[model samples]
Target chain A: MALLELKSVSRHFGGVRAVDGLDLVIEPGQIFGLIGPNGSGKSTTVNLITGLFPLTSGSIVFQNEDLEKLPTHLRLQTGIARTFQNIRLFGQLTAWQNLWVAQNSPADWAKRGFFSRWLGGQSGVREEISQLLEFSGLAHRQDELAANLAFGEQRRLELARALATRPKLILLDEPAAGMNTEEIGQLRERILKIRAQGTTVLLVEHVMELVMGVTDRIAVLNFGQKIAEGTPVEVQADAAVRKAYLGGGE
Target chain B: MDFYFGLAQIIGVHTLLGLSAYIVLLTGQVSMAQAGFFAVGAYAAGMLTVLAGWAILPALAASSLLGAAVACAVGFPALRVKGLMLVIATLAFGEAVRLFFFNFDYQVARGGVKLGPLGGEGFRQIRYFPENGWTTMQVMLFIWIFVVLVMAILWWLDRSRYGAVLRAVGEDELAAQSVGINLTAVKVSAMTIGGAIAGLGGGIYAHYTTHIEHASFGILLATFALAYPILGGLGSVFGTVVAAIFVQGFLVEGLRFLGDWRNLLFGALIVLAMNLRPKGFLDAPTLRWIRRVFGGKRGAA
Candidate 1:
């Protein structure tokens, strides 16, 4: 069974059909890539999946359960988490605190009492957060406020924060937007590592280097519709994708 | 000595009020409805003690519960609006609470003398402390006990995961929500806790002053409730306490010899303070410095 299924999902902004008749099936453990040019409804599709904006038509199902009425936060509780296109870290909170607040996984919610989860001392949970900080190469910077971190470090922290939720499917909207080659390479390894842990990734990106290197399957979108869907090699060979990306005769 | 005790009582109550706003402000909502919750607590506790003949402690507890209930109820609808609209919504709710007290009239004959809230005249003779034979110093200490309790709780909360969650929401609502923080639950819970604190403070204020009227819980009180937290900085709960002392003690009481002219300076001083310290009077950096100088535990959250 597919981990996520989008059937004819459409989100229209009045006269503009931001995402029209989009259908996608993401199998579990696959690193899926959603590539599109600017204004091609890539972010809108992500927003729809995360319930930031409701769909104008059709349905989205996760683990075979309909997600029509689920709220944004509840969607995360159901094991779907995402990062922002532009960095939106809690500027006032420390890097450690940022991931601390995102520990909304089912296990975290069920095991701890209400008081212990929220109001009690952080002693019990410090070990877990420390491990996450170490994974993101931020052990030394754990106490530093997120705003003071360098740009690349902030991006890594955001990814680690999303992972803290222990999501089954992570939607990363341009995680490598403003990055040097070294940073992108690091991010690619991180994406592969996330997939190795059995969590699926939906990478919506403009940077072809990371997507082609990491994604197991690729889908190209143009004008709010899927133009091509296949393996990386197959997608690169598609004529429709070529026209969408490089614009030519027919 | 009595004058100092009375001033101490005022500072204590104002600290509770400021801390209430501090929690709500952490969630990034600028609520002007705190005075409404305070007024509800004041009236509820006064009626319980004066008319129902309840003990002061139980009456104050009831007052806190009522305040939290009203705030939780109002939070659902009022919190739907954001930014300036939310401000207007809360400001209007505060005024509505004041008007309710203004037109509210409930009196009962006790020992052949009418007692209770009498509309615009306000609820007078809330003399629980005096009737119980508690001295001014005792009452001051009593108020400070609650103040210290609230401060300790908030201080602990600031160190907890919930505190980080509140700050997360304030920093970015969208990101916070996307990260699985329920915008409604987090926001409403903050408001409810804030209401309880304000309500407890108001109950204490009614007893200390021996009087409370609709005019007391007006826009000015609400503004002051918000101002203390902002001036204190959102760095920690201590900021709110210090801000309350600075405003209620130094600005309002310390300059009393300046007569009516002090009011002008009060406004100027607050503005100047804000200009000099845009983040707050006790921002994170300043707080860190204080801890360093005082030889406190370095890097303690």
Candidate 2:
């Protein structure tokens, strides 16, 4: 069975069919790329799958469980997490505090009573957070306020926060959007490292060059419908994807 | 010299009143009838001590119990409402409670049936605990201790996951709901906790004041309570208490200099606190910059 599947999903916003009759399957551990020109409904598809918006009409099955009905957070708890196109970090909190909130820490829950979790302090949660920060290379700035971080660092921090949730699958929406080429190179390495740890990744990116380098397979969309799905090399040679991009170039 | 010390002793109520107002302010809700509930708890303790001839220590303990009980009872409905609607509801409840004593006829006297404090003449003799030197002073000490303890507990709670979730839910309901924080529980818990603290303060206050009158807890008291919190800043635990003491103490103690202008001074103070620093005392981040210019230490948020 596919790790995640969307069956006949469609969404319309006041007579504009943003996504229509889409059927897609992401197999276990595949580094799939969802690519299209501007306003091709890539983000909407991610939102729909993450339960950010209720489907117009569809069924999304994640790990054999129906995910269309679950809320975004419930989906997160069920080992599915996605980063936003626009960063949504809790600005007032510190970097580690933001990361800590993303992870479901079992520290002194009143429902679970006091003495049981009182002794389970910062050291335990700190080690896990430290490791994730280390992987994302954000450990140095862990104590800083999230809002104060540089734009590139903020994107890296978002990656760390998503990893903190320990999701089986991660949906990254333009992790390299505002980064310099060197920063993008670092990000590509980190994404590869993240994939090596057995987390399935589905990336939605506008950077054609970025998608071509790492994506094992690419699905190209135009006007909310998938027009091409093949290996990166195969999709690069496709006439329709080239026509779609040429019609709406960066 | 004796008058000054006595005045200072009386001023101790300012500290407790400030703490009570601060607690309600922290969670963005106020029970204008706190003074009413405060009286209920206080009267419960006073009646137990004077009428039942119970030990003062046990009576004080009973007072807190009565306060919490009354809070839970009143909180049942008041906790569900919000903003000015809640303020009005608590105000009416306080008035109803205060009016019940003088307006309603009571049958007292170990089985003798009489109605009203007017008809029941002998009750006045038993109204107050006999003036024991320094007893009021000792109650004042307990209030200080309780305030410190409450502040400490609240500080820890502010750093906890429960507190974080409450904040999360408060800021963005959609994000918080997505994170699975219960909005209803956060709202009610804040009200109950704030109400409980106010009630406890009221119980202690009863012993210090040594009198219970219908006019004692009016809408003015509620307005003053509301004003104390706003002047300090509503969200910060530290700011609210400071603002509370600043407003109440200045109006009460500073007024000796200008007898007729005390209330005018109070209104002016609220206006100043709100206008100069709308976030209240320490709430404005701008204050930190001001402090730095004036050679003061930086404060935490």
Candidate 3:
């Protein structure tokens, strides 16, 4: 049994099927990469998995429990966290503030009794937030608002923030979208380090070099359906994936 | 202590109002219906003291609670609407409430209020506490000011982990959900805080005035109350305090010109501030220099 599993999951937008009858399994401590071209339902699948948008049909079982009835933040409490394809940092707050917020108590306390939870005798939460800020290498920029960070540093902060939720499963949507070669290399190292800490990574990236270098396995989607799923070597050699990318010139 | 004594009547009420404005803005809302809530608190408190024979301090507390209750009721209509629509809802509600008070004649002093006639005595009697006199004022102002320090409590909330989720929602609701934040709850809580602050201010404002009138709370006054925290600076609690003082100063100084131009000048300055400094004049980089100038005046040399 895998740590996260999806069986025949589907979503539709009033006639356009964004994600159609998809099935996937992600094991613990493994680096699984999801790849597809534009309009291929990769992001939609992520949204469905995170419970941001409800699934039209089928089932998502996480840690051996059905997740269809769960809310988005509850899923985070269940140890699932994901970053966006586009950067969405809170520009007004400092980098450390970003990580600190992500490290907050579960939605239950924030929901039922925020004042008590926020102000109770618990001082440990504050200390924990401080430790995370330093761990993310953002201690220096703790007071500097998020807008002031450089591009690559912002990406790293995003990773730190996702990690702040202390998720067993971290989903990366285009973690290397706009990085230089050296930065991409550094990102590869960072993703590798994240995995070594016993956190499972499911990355969706278009950077073939990084993906092929880091991902143990790759899943390819072509127009709302998984066309290929195998080890990186088998995935690259698959005839259908080659045709989907290079338009059959291969 | 000397400054508090000098500023006396306004300090507590204005601070509460300013903090409310700050909370409303934190949730990414800009409300200008504070004058109406102030009226609500004043009338409720005044009526209870004068007609119901409630003690002054308790009456004030009850008034603030009444204001919050009214604001919560108003939330249903306003929350469903978004920007400009929400602003309109606030204004319409303010106007409707003012008229409701204006026409409310509860058979207190002389005859009860009369609707449509537009020329009848109001329901509640104007309270006058003599001898011990200013004691109620002192208690009301001091105790409520203590509550306003609860702004520190709000500051803590805004800085906490939950605060980050709210800010994420404020900055971008869709992305916040992706990170597992419930957008509706965050937005509503912020709005509720904004409402509660208005309640606090309303209670203080009522006790200070000792009488509530529709003429005192109109669309224009609501805008002024909302403007204070913004003009001071929305970034810090102290910023809101400075803004309230600045707005009060501007109103007095700007009105020194033409006798009839007070509203016109107030409107123009607020529009200028809203346009030139969307975050408010205090957040402007140049304001740091202005603060230094003021600090110098306070014997900082």
TM-score per model (chain B) = 0.98, 0.78, 0.76
TM-score of 1: 0.98
Q: Candidate 3 overall Cα lDDT vs. reference?
A: 0.72
lDDT of each: 0.93, 0.68, 0.72
Clash pairs, model 1 backbone: none
lDDT per residue (tens digit) for residues A95-206 in model 2: 7766665664232143335432332323455777788888878888887877799888888887887777777788998877887889878988888888899989999998
Instruction: Sort the candidates on TM-score, descending order.
Output: 1, 3, 2
Off by over 4 Å in 1: B298-300
**TM values, all candidates:** 0.98, 0.73, 0.84
Residue B96 displacement in candidate 2 (angstroms): 11
Task: Put down candidate 1 lDDT per residue, B110-129, tens digits, no spaces.
Answer: 99989999999999998788
Q: What's chain A's TM-score in each predicted model?
A: 0.98, 0.92, 0.90
Residue range A77-143, candidate 1, lDDT tens digits: 9999999899999998889899989999888989898898988766888888888888889999998
Better of 1 and 2 by DockQ: 1
How many clashes in candidate 2?
A: 1
Worst 10 residues of 1 chain B by lDDT: B292-301
lDDT of 1 at B198: 90
What's model 3's lDDT at B188? 63
Taking chain A of model 1 alone, its TM-score versus the true chain A equals 0.98
Candidate 3 lDDT, B1-301, residue by residue in tens? 6334435446556767777667666666666666667777767666666667777678777776777777767765576677788788888888887888778666444246422112133433345353236665465556456556757777676655555556666676665665566656666666666666676666556555555567767876787677677676766666776666556655644366778878788778767877877866667355547657767342110
Tens digits of per-residue lDDT for model 2, B1-301: 5454444444444444555555555445567766766666666666676567677667766766666666667767786777789888988887887776546343356446431233212123333334455554454565667767777766666656545544554444444433333445555566555555665665555666665555666677666666655676644556656765565456667676888888787678667668888777776465556667888662322
